[model samples]
Every structure is written in structure tokens, then in C-alpha cells.
Target: MFRNTKMRLGGVNILLLTIVISLIVLYRSTSYCLCKVSPVEEAFGQPMKSQPRPDSGEHRVTCHIPGLESRKQFYQYFTEKEYKCENLRWFGSRDGRKAVCMDMEFYLVPQDCHVLSFGINNEWSFDDKFGAMGCKVYSFDPTMGKADHQRSQNVQFFRLGISNIKGQRKVGMGSRFDFFEVDRYVNILERLGLTNTTIDYLKLDVELSELEFFQDVFRNTPHLLRNIKQIAVELHHGYHGKGLNKTEDITDDSSDMSPISTYQIFWQYFHELRCHGFKLFHARRNGRWTEAVWGNI
Candidate 1:
């Protein structure tokens, strides 16, 4: 009877051992399956998938182009300048709405302050605020249709575009739509009886065309820029804008202007501004572009 009991006990132990082994194997299999069905991997491919490198072949091609070093130098100089909040305080929406320097010494006028705002992409927060402060704002944008004129009672909206030259020319960059019927800045200002008048603030965001526009204004209308107390500009300085490679030929024969490097154009424009006694007090970076505020101090 004792022998039979011991044999049964041994058999029971063996059965328990077999069940433990089976459970271990089953648990491992289930874990493996769960890993294979990971939500992150299923949604956006494998986590270890290769990504595009920051330095690509195109970067290598354009990396050592001429004027790049000068641009870097200028950029270093630009970033190193010290700015005090008291003299140049930030105004408007912090999220790029109308964020610009107040320049207490320059922008704050007593009364009858005039502002010449160029480039209207349906953004008028800056205009509206200044107009509320009793400033006569003249906003120009040739792209606007007739129905959208006089967007605000205080701001006088004109269906005209500003350019270095007068008349219509197809203006576009990359694969974007081109603009037509753009007018010259000098002619428009003269026609509006704005000559000899102090433009308290001159805001420009004319895309890549500002490169030429600045050059033209500096050459033809020096007094216009001088009379302006403050100049706030969004400088677009990428390959798509005025910063194309010098070797690339411009197919537009009507433009009369020769192709120039980004560094050359910017250097000339900034140098001219500095020569005209405009101080670069505030500069904010927005992706590939910069919002530069120059005040007459």
C-alpha cells in the first residue's frame, strides 16, 4: 500500500511539471505576438526606419557657394547686437500677428502720424492697432480685388502693388502663382501727395521683391526713407526668394534687372539702410525669414 501511494505521488508531480512548462511557452508566445502588433509600429512604420539626413547631397552642392561665408559673417554680426527693452519694446501679438518693436523714441508720435504699409495678405492687426491710435494708415496690395477695398474705416486700402519699376510684370517664385499689374512705389507715393510728409512708420513685407524695391527706393527716393521714423520689414532671404544661386539664369527678359546672389542683395540693402542712419534695433526669426525693425535713432 505504501509503494502504490508513492508511485501516485510521483505521477502527480510529473503532471504538475508538464503543466508549468506549457504555461511558460504559452506566455512567451503571447508576448511575442503582442510585440508584433505594436500600435506605434503599425501606424508609422518601424520605429527604427531610416530618416532623411539633415545634410543631403543638395546641401553639399550649395554649401560652399560664394557669398555664403559673407552671409554667415553678417548673420553673426546681426545676432550679436545688444537690444534694450526700454528703447525697443515688443508690441502686438507674440505669435507673429503684428509683433514689432514699439521704438518709443521713433514710433510714438504726437498726432497725425502717417503709416505706409506695403504687402497685404489679409493681415491688418498692426494697421488696426496703429489706426486706433489715431494714425492715418495707407495699405497697398495689388492682389486685392475691388470688392475687398476699404477693409477698415481708419485704414485706406488701395488695390495697388509696390515695385521698383512701374507697370505689370509676372512675379512668381518656384511653383507658385505669378502676380500682375504691380505699380511703382515712388509713383504711388507721389500721386497720393505723400511727398515731403513724415511717414511715422513704414512697414514692408513684400516677399522677395523687397530686395529690388529697397535698392530702387534707396537710389530714387532717399528722402522718402529718411522721412520715415521707423521701418519694419519681413526679410525673406532663402533660395526661393531673392537668394537664388548667381549661376542660375533668369528667363524673364522683361525684368531689366540682372540676377544677383542673396548675400549681395541683402548686404547692399542693409548697408544702404545703415548708411541712411537707420539703426537695426530688433530682429526676430520666423523659420527661413526674419522680421527686422529699423528705427531712426
Candidate 2:
């Protein structure tokens, strides 16, 4: 009887060991499968799909050509062509303030995404929506009355401005009389320890300063352009807008190019952006300016 009891105890121990080993193997396989799934897929339990390109039978306009001089030509070139983004979606305001391509590779792993939003004049809808989408957003606006603080769980607000050059420079907040100190885009990135990080989305609404900022990026730091995935900028043309009247001419850094009007510079900037592999995906008219979104092709 003693021998039988001892044998039974040994059998129970062996069964428990086998069960533990099998459970460990099952857990490891389950973890491996989970790791293979992307965050978007995990959230939906399926691959994120996009709509097929609409067969509108419309001939798409060719971009990056020179000699877009006239206002009519510029308007036609920008308005006629819309790049086919399969998963294009509007975020933020109900009026379609911001457009983001959801099918991009960056959206697959949204937790690792980062956005740099410039020129938020108290409109937090864009930043807030992006933050809620699991992207870490860094919003900068020197004109906003609030100081640098955490705007939300994932949004960080800074009292900085995008410029061509580094260091503090006075920029018009609302009018010619109201001015605030601002910093350069590269300088701000360095300050925020994001010089090497890939920017998933870059939102620029710096009034007329975008022209100078684009010149600086294309001329000096063209390499930085490679690290950016998407760009949404509000392009201001002519002298009718508030920023055109308040902000100074952006000639401080454009010594290489010949003298040109803001109209010519605007087209030139679009050309340069096209040369750098960015294609216009969306464009919307907002009063006197146009809000254009470009995706890296």
C-alpha cells in the first residue's frame, strides 16, 4: 500500500509539470501571434482597408512643371488635380478643417506616431483629434495667450513659432502692434529632442511665414524633408490676408534667389515641394488662402 501511494504521488507531480509546460508553450504562441498584428488591426480585429480609386475618367494634371506665373494658372493647377489617396479622411472640425490619409504606413502603428502642429491660434480641434488617435502631438503657437503646457493627454503645447532662422524674433500675434518672440523649426525640434525622429504629420498654418519656412527647408535642410511623411499647410497668396499686411517680407534668408513677388514665390515653393517627392492630396479654400495637404510619395 505504501509503495502504491508513493507511485500515485509521483504521477500527480508529473501531470502537473506537463500541464505547466503546455500552458507556457500556448502562452508563447499566443504572444507571437499578437505581436504580428499591428495596433490598427488589433483594434479592429482585421486589416484596415481603403476604398478603391474612383474611376471618374478625369485626366489628372501633371505637377512640378515650371512657369506657373499667372493667378489663373496657379488656381487651375492646384484646384484641378487631386492626388488619389485611398484612405483619405477628414479630422478635427465638422467643417473639414484637417485631412489625413489613414492608409499610410504610419497609421498602422499609431502609438509610435508623432505630429508637429504649427500655428494653432486657439483652434485645438486638430491637435485634440490627432492626440485622441494615439499620436503624440507637439503643437506650437506663439500667438496663443497660454504658456507652454500639456494641452491634453497626448498633446504638448509650446509658445514657439516656426521661422527660417533660429533664436528669438518678434512675430505679429494678431496685428502689427502685437508681437511675440518665436524660434526656428529646426531649433524647436532640437529643443524638443526630435531632430532624429520621423515626423508622421507636419501641420503648418504660420500665416505667411510658411513661405520663409519652406525656403529654409528646401534650401538649407532638404535632408529633413525626407523624414517627414505628410504636410498640411495653409498657403496665403497676394496681400489681402491679415498675415500679409502684418508680417514682414521673407527676404532675410532668400539671398540666393532673384527678386520675386510673393505670387511668384508661392508657385516656386509649390514646385520645390513637388521636386522633393510631395504630391498634393487635398486642397480647400478658406477665405483668401488655401489649405493644402501633401503626402510623401
Model 2 per-residue lDDT tens digits across residues 73-159: 667767754467788887788432688887755363567889999888788888888899888999988877789999789999988
TM-score of each: 0.66, 0.69
**Position 56, candidate 1: lDDT:** 23
Candidate 1 lDDT over 1-297, as tens digits, reads 999999999999999999999999999888744544324235434432233323222221121223334445656646754444355444344332444456566656645888888876677777777778878889876665543366665688887666776777555455554666666665667677876678888887776777767866665445456677878888765443332654433343222123455545675677667766677777768777787877766
Give the per-residue Cα lDDT of candidate 2 at 291.
86
Poorly placed runs, candidate 2 (over 4 Å): 1-65, 80-82, 94-96, 105-108, 240-259
Regions of model 1 farther than 4 Å from truth: 1-68, 82-96, 99-104, 146-148, 241-243, 246-259
